[model samples]
Target chain A: MRRIVTLLLALVCLAACTKSAGSDALVVGTEAAFPPFESVATDGSLEGFDIDLMRAFGAHINREVTFSSRDFSALIPDLQAGRIDAIASGMSRTKERAHVVLFSRPYARVATGVLVSTQRVADAAGLEALEGDDVVIAVQRKTTGEEKAETRFPNAQIRVYDREVDAAAEVAAGRAHALVYDMVSIVNLHAQHPETTRIIDTELGIELYAVALPLGSELAPALDAFLAAETRPGGKVDELLAKWLGDAERFRATEE
Target chain B: MTAQRERLVRGAVVMAIIAALAIVISLAPGEIRWALAWERRDLFLTGLGLTVVISSGAVGIGLILGVIAALFRVSRSVALDQIGRTYVEVVRGTPFLVQLYLWYWCIAQALQLHGLFGPREAAIVGAIGLGVFGGAYIAEVVRGAIESIDRGQWEAARSLGLSHAQALRHVVLPQCARRLLPPLTGEAVSIVKESSLLSIIGVAEITYHAKNLQAREYETWAAFICLAALYLVVTLPLTLLTRRMERRLAGEEALPVARL
Candidate 1:
């Protein structure tokens, strides 16, 4: 018991010590699994669209960039608690999120799509077509995909999986007719599982993905300036997105 | 010269294992991480609590349950015999984690059950899960020890006009105690290891806290490996104590032969 008390007190001291993170380095938060936006690449380096952009943005600001990778869900809470300076996870800058954190100008446009077996993608254009009271839709627990599934297909039975990869697998196995996820995730899914499944057309909940600084960050204005420089008047950011997420449309049009 | 040779061989074996592990941890690419290094102390403390709570809870309750269950096994009635067999078989048949999940998510999640039970959710689940699982194996060990008591001694005690309860309290129970300690010590070690499953239900036990550190810092390997080392530290002493008891009991047996 004395040891537990001592450990608790030590944690309190460590929490106190984290108040100052310094200006020389920027601590960037991201879920390294979300590809095109962020993921650990095949070569074992952290590589993705957001990663390249963040590195460039860090260079522009003359700050050394270091990333803390975690499950996507942890990114927002970490950002809100001031644990990281910014989030580069392909987090859609929702109006609801605007209340919690300041966003850089939209550096990447995002949209949602479905990863379904080719057969199911043939049958449905939207959630309503998928909801047959008996039909199952697999979605990641506590994600926007889950929320939309709940909102749109109220009658559809939902088996909540903890990760997007599992949800896509359910679709590929024909256990679930469809899966809801962001466009980047669907692209990655089809790329990985082209023989079994494919992504479908008609995006849902379209929004802008941005770099989020904490609520009332002194860094937001400067982040906005750099985002505009790269994306505002058509510079290298657009060209890079074209090369990376462009083949995504071909996957979206998958048949048979 | 004989002792020195044993010591030299032991030292070489230990040093070789350590050198191999050092190479693996160093050369494993992104697997080598320092992020969870900060919470190493916190992980140690939580693991200690986790070990003690499960070990003591399992051992303490296992003793009481073991006695009751063992009594049923020894009973003359067929119903009690069947009941004891069923309990032992059921508990022994399942894994500790499946039992833990059933207790934590199913039984503990029922709001009325939680409200009626005095202890907090995690504690109740951990206690019940560890207690029931430990009790099963303990029941068999206890039954074996109790039955091993010489039937002639029991007959002699009864011939002296002592009640069955008195025979148990004075003679049978004492004999059972020495036999039980060695196995009981092993059960305690298993209880400590089994407590790792409690982490899955968010108990803030050792593995749970280590996971929090790993997730926050992205140091999966270091956090878990160090946490495993902490568990070894706690359980190794208990394990040695148990082994010593076995040695002591072995010495007691040699005493009988010497007297003969």
Candidate 2:
């Protein structure tokens, strides 16, 4: 027994000693399912405004940026665990999240909107009209839109989904009364499935999107500085905004 | 090189090596600071509580289903045996995550459509799903334990005028308990570990809370180490209990023999 225990102890020590060799790459976490911001393409590569911006930031810092796609709700936990050095998902700067993570300067602004089946679009008139026990609201889990839906429509039954597209599909199938999400995502979904869904004109609220870093992280100052320089007039932020959302004047007007 | 001194030296060396590793990890820059988990202890406690609840509920359900499936497996009827075999085969063949989604997304969605339940019931569905999955494996453990007994034991009970059920309950099962304890404990541990998957469907178990804390604090190493320690608290006691039960069942044979 003693010999076996000694052998196991030696093996454990060897494992622990080998694991301490670390790397210099900056790991960034994102949910690559949210489009016009970040999404997976046909070739299984991550692409979007956030991906481009993060790659640019990585180049500026002279560190290789590695992206890890995870569920949006999981991004903060991954960041906290040091699984990822930063979050470049289209996360909004909210008071609740700010308590846990440090947010860089707002890179862009987005409006929250409701998407409903065309038949219910007239009934959905606005956020106020959708608040009732009979209404079922679908929102992506851990997103600003879900938080807003929960607080604003307290009576409505809220269903949280893992993906934005899933939430939109619930409304498209008429199983859900509406989906509360960012305007750009809802608009894009509506454009793709025009016959099935429509975006309600009622504006939930405007939110500023920013990158999230660990609280008191050593990288926080450097990230904030980079973001400040990038968001300046005629900087990388403008170029990205033009490339991704410029086709629509409304989206361009919302850019920070 | 006395045996007693040799054992003491071995124990001391293991402890010294462990202490060295602890120091190295603590001194390393950017290493996980375990103290960070202390700040979010309440969150972890909540997660631990949910994990225990889900695991216990699933294990209890699994044990009951296991007995039924085992009975079918050992029964004389071909149809019943086939039913048991198919259930165990199919459930054991598929991935657990797929089964969890089937229960949470498909079955739960259908339940909601019929107004039988709502989305919040996914945790209950998840527990039951885990139980059903575990039952398939547990069924095999039980069948193996029962079959491992000598054939003459059943014949001896029959000669004493006991019915099949009475023979099983009073004669066969009592003996099988000793053989079954170790593997049953192993199954229990697996069920507890698998409960972490419940987090994907939003069960808010230990892994979920760990992720939440990590996301909130960005202290990845601290959160995971704490998570591992919490799981150990559940599994370690079970392992010790199994050993104790095994020794107790072994009777005087388990006692150390006197050196001649």
Candidate 3:
């Protein structure tokens, strides 16, 4: 009977649906708020160094990479839950984070610095000069820059902001005395608001950015291999740095 | 069966159904294992407590502001009524998240210039933001409930030589309270859900803690399921209580509605 055959077909489809279908597509999670790393444009398209790198890596690995934007704090959890295959946000590799998720090879090195209002302070020597009870520093929450600012300037009142732009804006608006963040982001902010803000010539410390993966994930080794080949002399990484950073010499200087 | 006995039986059956479904979902080998969430109960509980505290604080503030705004809205004075109407329209028109940011980032900055508050303490600002936002909706509810009462009640109170304030306080508001209860409960639930937005500014509420667990454990399904269950625990009781209150106020027999 046609009805019996139809019932049999329906049961077969239901059975197939119950079992998880394995796919080769890679779901990459990113916090698109960090510009030049991963940022969403006005048209809702993702554009940044991290986006391009992931697409290039996906091509190298022969997998269809799908990107999902999430809160910066939620990216790792989404990855661990298998909701995402990997993270391509500009996340720095640290010992504490390595306990939970595997990290790919370091893609780029960046120094932390302070951004101060040009009108407020004429010249700043280093991190110590800016340290005092009266000076209030703004830093993005859950960042190494925040940690560094806390330790380096214990006397200074620290204001933690959810977004790097907000922290920079506080300094620009003259509410906060200075903003502590990665040098690349500070430079970008200064470029955008040159008259209001200036990057203080203080090198806090160097940190390396890498892709985060779930622990014991098969994708980890593959991403690491791709990063190794692509970041070699005059490779894809150099191309990205030139395109986004504008001056490859500054990023290259800290390479060694 | 007696009406009270029947209601008790119905309540038991519903609870049993919920329990059986929970057991089946937890024991089933699938993407969402409730056990994963059960293990992180402490973290979730802390988040829930914070959520309740923030929402209740907002609700408390909202009630006072709502009453004042409603009074102003129905007042004889044109200026006061216009001010009240504008406050409700402006607040209700904007998204809560934008209002939150406006309070946290812009207004907080302005306040800091006057040395009144610090921008770093965002939780207080978030509670105040939720309160101000909820007050607009609550004002409408209060006005509607007050207006729903017959104009005869007001005239009767005036004939009894009661002033407008005395009549509103003694005669009309008591009637409005019963009509207001269900919607006020709904507003309270919404306030609890909206408290999740506070997590954006890092308030360490339930959603924020859930994200922390998800990020750390990498179990999104389990983390979110737990989050949903925790919220249900907070909201379900209020919903049942509201239903019971509505039934009691209606003077209906204590008969349970039949289930499928």
Candidate 4:
């Protein structure tokens, strides 16, 4: 009799596991490498600028949010694998990416800049002049810098690294000529390198970071509606942007 | 001279095209953020602690549990023998993660075990998951090591007027332990690496740290590569130790001594 009861329970559980999961809790996927965007703190709490912003965005969408952290490059693959419903990393919506995944309207737009060493800036007039045979530029893998470099300095030697921090670190260590990244990270990185790298006015391209969804997801329309409603002047998104961006300035800007 | 110059120019242009393509394929905008995180010391320490503590604790507990089951099967008792067989077979048939998930997430929570443990109860869940999963393989190791002891050795110990307990403690156990060490160490290494899976329940081991770094840095590949290297750094010592022990055990006599 006891054996019979146990067998029946096991059968029920095996059946239950295969059922489609509903999105009661928003299963937001993120690659938590970007500080001030999404990062796991010392206390095991996920905190950052994007996290704060996402919390506000979730409220605007009338959804309770939860996060699954994965490798940054795996976000798109994870989303396609049905492991996550949406991606909230600092993903730039580009023409190539649009073919693979649907992106929401931009919540935050970051400017692009080139950070060169203090020593290099004294001699260099412009990027075109710096394109000598010895010039090597560092940038992150699978990001807009690769595309921008193609468009801007096709002949310039580009060195690719696994992450932005490493590439930027290379520049500070005098390993690369300069690093290309968004203005926010460039400004933040300067704190460590102490003006060893400086920004150049020579433009590459501007990318708008947006929330991404699996292509043809039913949830996309609903999220788009929320973004559209919130982006209106003095609406909830503006307030959230102010609050999150303001909060980040206090906590995120300091490492020590 | 003109032809050679033309060829040199064409060769230089080809190399430049290759370099340009390489930049596009490999370089991106966000690699530094993840790389810096991979180099962070605090996260590495946290992950190291969780991996060792969970794996060692699980293996220690599993050793005790597996021995008890293995002995029960060898003992001339019907009910205990059935229990051992059932446990070994069932454990072998199921995947470890499934068992772990069931133990920590579904069954324990349903039993309201979190209140019985503490507020941040995932650690207990992870340890217990480790214990249960570790026990399955440990049972097989115990049975094999014990059974490998010669029948003559058992009889010889008995003929010398030694108590059954004394024979096991003094004679059989030392040999079995020495023989089991390699598998046991392998199991330990496995436990440490496998603890990465417990991050699903929020253990914050190295893999979790890597993922967190990847999410923020958006440099997923480097973080994961660093994580892989970290795990190797942790396990490679055990690998060498196991190799040394295996060599020590290689040139011995039959049954309990060593063979294939």
Candidate 5:
């Protein structure tokens, strides 16, 4: 117990010291499991649409950007507590969230999609068709998908996972009837496991994605201006969208 | 220091520490509200019920596997001894989280049994994973307890015309029971704590519910504190019971062995 207490005290001191020392660097928290937005590459480096955009914004402001990978649910609490200056994960901006954090202008629009086993693609065509007591739906924790599953399929068995990939894997394994997650991630999972999983035709409503900062943060105006300037045609946002998502009709249809 | 003074000092120190902690929590921030978690008590209660069920299932499985493995280790046959040792070593060597995934996703899928599996099947697999992982340590504990008995007891029973199996039932196992109690209780408590790892596989236990609540409500500290408290509610009684048993057994240790 004494040794554990000593170790904890040392850790607290270290955290305090490092936090004070890195005031100049902007710390951004992200959950890197969502593909096309934020994900770790095979080579152990962070690379994705959100990552590139955050780095571009950091360059615009002339501050060094440091990315910290955390659980999806932890991003907001970390930002509120000042552990991270901003959140750039593929998080949808909602009214409930806007009450707690300052959201910059919407950067992109994405829709929730459903994934099912290839064999069930013909039968389970939409979310409504799978609403039953026996149907098992897999959703990533803290995502809009979980919210939708709770409200839509009130009787379905909902299994929550930390990552979309795991939920998709459940669909691929035939353990779960469907996976409710962002269309981009669902597309990514279908590409990776083409033989086992297929996309459902029904698309959930489009949601605006934005960067979240602590309430009344000084960084809000600058972030908004940066987003406004870079989201136009042939700007950094367009280039990132082209580079990461390409001109796929399914993706373009989700664009606002 | 006098004994009375020592007790008073200890009591004062504990109260002071608790007071300091309370002050720290109170000073944190307006957003850190504990009441937000209290409203979702139903989620936590259901999760705790599942946690108890999983732990009980694991304990039942572990006790059965442990005894069998212990017997194999103490047996004279080389093949049985090798199988016992290999089972213990392999289970103990791997991380429990990886083992859980291998059991739920890989092994269950390969058997073609998980296609229709849901929460119920997931809970059963979680229990089996925890039990298989814990059986190794329980095997060692039971083996050591059995070995602690004097070999002369077996010889005396045999000379008295008792069969090998009868000698074990009449002479060895009674003494082994007392020695096994403490370690077995400890193993059971450890299994209860280890059941938290089942949350990753989607068993809706206390930690799983806590994570969901934390994610949805963003009450990280409140959600986790409630989880820790629920675990303590289950584990503290077991720990206290073991301590009482150990005390009673310690007194019995002073008495002479019962006459054969």
Candidate 6:
């Protein structure tokens, strides 16, 4: 009788294990190369403002949140193919991207900034100085920075790297005249190459950072509700902002 | 070319073209849509043009480096041979992508740091990286071809009052040409394929544009399929040339006098 009971329990457990996954878990895809928002820590695990915030949301909603690292460009396509649940990378909610994917309410604000060699810090007072034909502006491919460079500096040559760090390296090494990227990345670049590179004070335009979800996703409302609550004063978003970025007041975009 | 062989080559080329097209059409996500990408054909064309330029530049520099390194490898001096061996071993042992980063960032940065050379265009740096990477394998290929020439040929030339350099230049080196052609053409095709790596460093090659198109258009499969087709178009001639050289060499082997 005991043996029969053990056999029946084993069969039930096997059947439960073989059940289909019905969205109890959220697989968040992120490009960890973007510091502050998301990046790989020394322990070879993902840790950043976005990673923590996603985890917090998972805790609140009573679901398991898993993280996957991907190239910045591959995140959206992966989401569309049902390979990932949400994109928590430092992706801007631009009109072009919004057309294809649903974006959560703005969680963070970013603006375009130029990073130049230390010698050209004063000369490159604004984007106008970088509009010359001889100027070579470095940008990460398929980013808003590339679009801005193309529209803002028609005469200036544009060089696109796979990673923003490479473009920053180009500017730091003096191979390229300037790097046009997100203000946070520009600040990070200046921090990394303090002696060789500096960030321009002028911000091009305000851009919003948000969590991207697949079109018509059931999780959109829950994500937006979470973001709405967290973005308030003394909320989780403020805590994250203070923790990741110290006194980045000037770089913040005025929410419209 | 023999009539039958030419016909065979032609048939193979047509079939390859058809197969390439079929693969692109079949692999497209959902309904086949070419107009979305075709409307932006200029992007692909520009990328193809840049790829050609980079590959040509890299091949030019690689040939020069390969020749110099091959001479060191084949040299009778121990120091020269050691230098050649070290370069080939070091370069061949490492990954091409890492070498490219070293070239673009570390080495190039050092040059700029010391004021030895000013900022260079990424394309120029990328071409040099590809050249340096290709030079190692090319050096080995060239060295092998030169060594394959019989020891008696060198002895005969030296016996006829020719200096060591003259014997190598006039007799052994010239005879190595037949053996070198097929392999050299093979290397050229590889260089073309390897040029795709330059996209990482911002050379704006075909692969770069393809990636951009994919990300922007969200036609991931279409973008890469077009990229594949473009690469095939570029490498097809070199592949054919390699085959032709191998065939010609095989036919010529039956007649010893014709080999010369």
For model 3, residues A112-181, the per-residue Cα lDDT tens digits are 8889877566664556657779888998877788888998999999999866766776787788878888
Give RMSD to native, each candidate.
Answer: 12.6, 20.6, 22.2, 15.7, 22.7, 23.6
Q: Summarize candidate 1's per-residue lDDT along A1-256 as a digit string, tens digits.
A: 5975786477445433443334347878877656666665322346777788888888988888887655566567656644468998777777777888888887766677877776564544554577688778898765677777787778988878754655776787778888888877787677766766767676776657788889888888788777676673346576667766774333221111
Model 3 residue B139 lDDT score: 95
Q: Write the per-residue lDDT of candidate 4 for residues A35-117, one digit (tens) a residue.
A: 66777774566776567666776787788888876556657755664556788877888898888899987766666778876
Task: Name every residue pair that clashes in candidate 5.
Answer: none
Sorting all predicted structures by TM-score, with the top scorer first, yields 4, 1, 5, 2, 6, 3
Model 6 chain B: worst 10 consecutive residues (lDDT sum): B112-121
Tens digits of lDDT, candidate 5, B59-162: 87788788889888987788998999999999999988889878866675565433233214467678888999889889999999988989999889999999
For candidate 5, give the lDDT. Answer: 0.78
Candidate 5 Cα errors over 4 Å, as ranges:
A1-108, A111-256, B1-13, B27-30, B115-117
- What is the C-alpha lDDT profile of model 6 across A1-256, one tens digit per residue? 5975786477445434433333357879887667778765433356888899899999989999978765677677656755578999878898999898999888888878888886654554766778889888899877889998898889999999877766776787788889888887787778766878877778778778889999999988888888888777777888887788764354242364
- Global lDDT of each candidate: 0.70, 0.78, 0.77, 0.71, 0.78, 0.77
Candidate 5 per-residue lDDT over residues A1-256, each given as its tens digit: 5975786477446545644564688878787666667764423356788899999999999999877666677678656645578999988888889999998887877888888886554554666667878888999888889998888789989999976656776787788988888887787777766777888888877777899999999999999899888876667887888888874233331232
Q: Could you give me the TM-score of model 3 versus the true structure?
A: 0.51
DockQ of each: 0.04, 0.02, 0.02, 0.10, 0.02, 0.02
**Candidate 3 residue spans exceeding 4 A from truth:** A1-24, A252-256, B1-260
TM-score for each predicted model, relative to the true structure: 0.54, 0.53, 0.51, 0.56, 0.53, 0.51
lDDT of model 1, residue A234? 48
The residue-by-residue lDDT of candidate 2 on B1-260, one tens digit each, is: 99999999999998999899788668733556566677667767877898899888788779888878998998778998899999999999999999987876677555552122222254677788999999999999999989987788899898999988888888888777777888899899999999988877556678866664543333456767789889999999998888897777678445574211
Number of backbone collisions per candidate, in order? Answer: 0, 6, 4, 26, 0, 0
- lDDT per residue for candidate 2 within A1-256, as digits (tens), equals 5975786477446544433433467778887667778864433356889999999988988988877666788788656645568899889999999999998888888899888876665654666668889899999999999999999899999999887766776787688888989988888877755777777887889988999999988877777788787676677888898898874334432443
> Which residue pairs clash within candidate 3?
A77-B214, A77-B215, A80-B218, A81-B218
The list of candidate 6 runs beyond 4 A from truth reads A1-252, B1-28, B113-120, B258-260
Model 4, range B117-236, lDDT digits (tens) per residue? 432345566776777777777888988898898887878888999877678767777778888989988888888877888765555677777766654444555676678878988899
